[model samples]
Target: MLRIRPRALPVPATVLAWPVAVGSLALAVAALVLHASTVGGLRDTTNLHLADLWLSVLGPTVGAAVVARDRRTGLVLLGTAPIAVGAVAGAYAVWSAEVGGAPGAAAAAWLATWTWVPFFLPALLLPVVLRSGAAARLGAPVAGVLVLIAVFSAFAPGPAGPFAAVPNPLGLAWAPWLGPAAGVLIGLTAVVLVPAAALLAVVRWRRASGDDRWQLGLLAAGEAVFVAAHLSPVTAQPLSDVLVAVGLTALLGSVALGVHLRSVTAGLRRERELLATARETERLRLHRDLHDGVGPELAGLALQLGAVASRTGEPVLRELEGRLREVVGEVRRVVDDLRPAGLDASGLAGALRERARAFSAGDLTCAVEADVPDGLPPAVEVAAFRIAAEALTNAARHAGASTCTVRLGTEPGSLLVEVADDGSGIRADAGPGVGLASMRRRAEELGGTLRVGAGPGGGTVVRAVLPVPR
Candidate 1:
């Protein structure tokens, strides 16, 4: 059954991201139209303008979706930077287009800012995503260089600077040489960092498994197509725009697919666990019913047969009574095998202690030291007890052990049971038999593990670790 819990509304990243992208695209198209109308025709609009508009819309959409899906702090910071830059630049473009400024200067500034700035955020983040720590180390210096470039561009004086499109937009024209010098630095930094990020992504792709590889491959392909569209000669503007749009759509689609796959995988895993738990619960209930119902019936029958044997001294009756008593014992044993009574009565510790006592016989000393907390789930307790009993039995009978120890304790989020014997170590040819296999199965049924091997003191050790369900 699917359970839905009431929670506060999810952050609106997914909801906001796509609409923002579409709106940005519409605004960009509007800006282009305005420019075309003002300047007289579509022929006046540059391919660079089209490329910038697409990039500005595409970058933030991808970023927002990624940040929402991953929810990583680093990704959030990285994704937000591009969106912030784009928003400001987009607003400026609208203002410049509608209000009309130093003819084409403002439009050029908007195009340049959007074209260069939007891609930089994704490029910077790519390295971090690819090779987490190594990327961080490498990216720090690259980031510092980029920051230096920004500082230089902002403070640079004249229109010939790196940020020439929006020259002195920040009113840094007080220093002319600063802009040109920073622009050079920015170009050089991009040349180095962009290739490095791409290389890191390639390395990541080589190492990535399953869904991750697909996601990375799709992102790479989309980015490559988008970049190629911009670089290719602009023979047909409409065709170019269509191609760029297709590339961006592909990239966004991949992100969505990845998110969907992750959610489906998680849901499937939860369902499997729930199904397993249900099966176990039903098994335990059946065992409990058999123990509670049939066990007492057989015991009562044995008692009545004994009373009959005393009353009537017939040979057949006596013989039948003996056989019936054996059958009763066998029935009880079967019930205990299915689910230990001690486990039901007093939890794991009591169960282990009782088992240890039962296994203790002449020439074999069995000691149980258990500090397990009370009220563990019935399944866990039962499995742990069974495993421990089997281990102790093996140590006492097969191991030729004089001294056997059963220890029960708790580890973080789990219960630990270990049965060790100081005896002749496991024989090489003495393969795992039904008893050992049974113990292992019991442990595994409860999503736990069992290990049987030579102990530290040159004897056998049987250890089972069972998870404690909350």
Candidate 2:
């Protein structure tokens, strides 16, 4: 059994990011209402704000705690625990921030910052951190979600309420540091976010297996260039945020495609291997059938023919030799039927001739006509030969036919094989025997149909029509 270690994570680190972000927003809203309102609301707002801060700080700290625990305690203990790193990180981010400023503005700013941390970190490190462990699996989706949140917030209106910057009504502007300060704050936030993401990603990459590391490395490197351009001076912040959203979506799409392609390729390879094995098994089975069934039977016929030759004065000896020769030939023909070997060189006509020679016995006049052209497909040749042989044998044995005629001629866009016998007429509703049923199966296998009905002169005629190969 393959022991897949539960990815190392802190207790309570498994809270999904969306819930964390939503809960943080809810806390901010509650705190803002209390802070902005009268006496009764103020106390409640302070408590909520404090709770938010506690959560944010404790979240990531627990992750480090778990890592420490893993370092000291053992991976086995961690396996028994349900703690996950992402949940902890999300919880930590949710609870850490101070909820002190204006309601709307402070909430937007905090959400933006919190979301940015995971976004930038994962974007920067997911590719690099795909080592041999749990981190690799967690990196891409975590980072992607963070980027998505940031993109959503970028288009939202600026922070309002208590957190809003003081508005200037006069002609002269008062605050010089305000504009540049905001820009610097945004830039610094981005920088800080990148490294934190890298920590998680690098840990993951180190723990990953085989080509997984290479795949993450390639994906992460491309993401880096894209992130740099988004955070750069050349683009609008809003547009850059959108671009990040698009990039993350594309990265996720690529991961999905990669997984799908890998599965499909694996399936195709397995099928091909199975097919080769099947062919080998069939070859072995055919060799055994021919050797066990046909080989001894023909040897017995040869012995009988030798005995007949020794009994010189008897008239029955000549007939016995002829019959034994036919039996030996029939055994060889049945053995050859195991697989179609040389339809290309001998053609359908030659195969039929061999079959006729095989079944020639007393009162069975077998005539085979080979007017049909050579170079017809191998499938057609094999189908034609089997159908003709089956029809001839059925006529000679069951129909008590004195004469059998096999005609092969090419019709317009079709190849026709007609076998007619001059013997007792078939009943109007005669159910097909095993030999005729086999001929029908052979014809159908090659995209053709076989028919057995009354001949004009009180006999049975079997006809098969097959398509000309393209």
Q: Which candidate is the best by TM-score?
A: 1
lDDT (Cα, tens digit) per residue for candidate 2, span 417-450: 9999988868767776777778876665555667
Which candidate has the top score in lDDT? 1
In model 1, residue pairs whose N, Cα or C atoms come closer than 3 Å (at least 3 residues apart or on different chains), thus clashing, are: 156-179, 157-175, 157-176
lDDT of 1 by residue, 87-158 (tens): 334444444544556365554443334334434545545535532545556656665766676566444554
**Predictions in order: lDDT:** 0.62, 0.52
Which residue window of length 10 is worst by lDDT in model 2? 72-81
Q: How displaced is residue 42 in candidate 2, in Å?
A: 84
Off by over 4 Å in 1: 1-15, 31-70, 73-157, 160-166, 171-255, 313-374, 378-470
The TM-scores of all predictions, comma-separated, are 0.56, 0.30
